[model samples]
Target chain A: MDLATCLKKMELVGVLAFATVDSDGAPQIRNISAIHYESDAIYFFTARGKNFCRELLEDGRVQILCYTKYKEMIRMSAKAYAVPEEEQAKWRDIIFEEQPYLANVYPGDTRSIGIIFCIDRAEVEYFNLGVNPIFRDTYTLGGGTITKKGYNITEKCIGCGKCRTKCPQRCIEEGKPYRILQNHCLHCGNCYENCPVKAIVRE
Target chain B: MDLATCLKKMELVGVLAFATVDSDGAPQIRNISAIHYESDAIYFFTARGKNFCRELLEDGRVQILCYTKYKEMIRMSAKAYAVPEEEQAKWRDIIFEEQPYLANVYPGDTRSIGIIFCIDRAEVEYFNLGVNPIFRDTYTLGGGTITKKGYNITEKCIGCGKCRTKCPQRCIEEGKPYRILQNHCLHCGNCYENCPVKAIVRE
Candidate 1:
């Protein structure tokens, strides 16, 4: 599908997934209920003095996951920082509409009521759940679009099954020599990078 | 809902989100397609040699985002590391079932496959999205039937809007006293922890 088509579908039924770091440098994930998607940025809210809030201020890197009800998912990696007062005032109404209660709270607090992410780069992957025989056939006939990207299993695998366990698609099989179920693989490349032996290679 | 009911509801409907650090010490977000709930840990797959894989290997500190298709969302902070090889071999069949093509793949090749992430500690936040007034009322009325935890905003907020932009809920509002929209809040605490002034206080 085209970008506009994908975006429209996402806007209609998209769900936002978030991942952030804690004060101790551990990762955290949550679902966002309200997200303001701007051409250049996105915005959301949280309480004052949270660990994640501190992580962002100390380091502005962030990742956003947006998926459609139908399974299409998009991942965005960006730098996040606080919005200045002048900018916050301009977007106050837009922010309030999405979150009405904000109008009542945060009247005299010293804490910031908002945060923004300025996207530097984004990687989008679109998938259709139902069968699309036509596209499959075309790709098949087209000699299977060469994905120069392939995984290399190094000597460091250590025969560990951690890859098998963590695979969202269950594509890794543990045996004499670990095997990867390519057809079922989403190419997220978790296995390649996580191997203790550096067995899996993506090139 | 009980664990069984919650698991059933999440069968084909769970969203997995996570964060990892780059070489520069900045955090990045990534999404997992499927999450396997084992006895005491959660598993998902990615290529073996990616940045996240490297980050996890070097520092097992990680966080997770798991939600039930919108009915409930949970954020977890945990430590993760690779599993052992002998154990991995035992689960080979189950992994193969999920990825049938593994049979055709090589096992001993250095650039083949491996496992990652065995969660150690975790915190869960349950968000109930039931439309029925009964479910909502029960929780709202303090019936204790629906369970959830609350957080407090600290006195460290410096009025920075970083949390607002990074929030998935758009619950933060920027004003003189900056405030948060608790009604729609998901309690992800992106704003609270990311605030420059450490304003967000989690109770």
Candidate 2:
């Protein structure tokens, strides 16, 4: 799936698990549904006094993840910042209107205590397990950059095919230097660990 | 629910979401089922080369969470450390015996690539949304300290009953200093924000 499809899937899932680092340096997570998705960004609401809000304000780094029923895992990593003062109300109203249940938590004027934060740029990872041998890809929203992962065979290859034999997905191909099929790789590092010649390098 | 009950519930759920902070301080999370629970501790397995394993090794702080079908949210915040090198194989074998599917991922001696980690101290929070007004409580396992949360009315309470009127749970009681029923509190800060006297303090 592409960037837009990933965003659309997250919208369809509605609620997602959000992870953030607290002031004490421990990881904290909770399920949040108060979100308004944009083609290139995501806006969510949290009370100003809540720890979730404080964490976001102090350190904007956050990760939003969802595991769909079809065994697709979508994760977005980005820094979230509160909307500009002038546009907070506009975005908050849009979210509250979309998520009616939120009214019960912050009725009427109480909603003013809530703040809206936006993720304008993020690295999104799409990993699907429903397909045999699995499949994974990375995409960037806005200007976020993708982090390279998985293993690659180097020129140090002896062509012993040891990496191919140990690969759970059997994704390694023989040549002067073995080739790893990136799309179907599990990134489990089985081949990397078993390579007799240390010819594999992590990307 | 008590600590044991919460642990048992997590065991029944099989797979749970684990959140951690990577080297870059970005939040990372994944669903893991390779777990074994004890009366006051938890043991789990992860491959040594995976990012998840690297994060745990570098920073032991972690949060494990599971949301049940009955709208119960159970979260455990703790620092996890790799089991003693001498005992690693013993725990890993026990986990593999309990979780047969793991054999498919690391068959035969390849399992040696995995490592076991233990969480012997933790503060567990149980929050249930199935009940009206909600319910929440905290428990410590293996002497982990609980971090105080929610708000409390101080002697500055004016007896105006304004906090009570605004409390969604309506759990505040009339007194010289209004008392907040901690167990039933949503910790949403509605009363704290609406209090005219500003008598409420976060616990």
Indicate which candidate wins on TM-score. 2
Please, what is the TM-score per model?
0.57, 0.92
Q: After superposition, how far is residue B127 of candidate 1 from its true place, in Å?
A: 3.4
Clashes (candidate 1): 90
True contacts kept of 2: 0.41
Error of 2 at A82 (Å): 1.3
Model 1, range B109-188, lDDT digits (tens) per residue? 32134453565334433455432211211111112133333344544556677877756555567875567666556454
Report lDDT per candidate. 0.52, 0.87
Model 1 agreement with the true structure over A6-87: per-residue lDDT tens digits? 4455456545666666555656555554456554345655443344566667765565666665545555445566667577
**Candidate 2 i-RMS (Å)?**
2.0
Relative to the unseen true structure, what is the C-alpha lDDT of residue A157 in candidate 2, on a scale of 0 to 100?
92
Interface RMSD of each: 8.0, 2.0
Candidate 2: residue B97 Cα off by (Å): 3.8
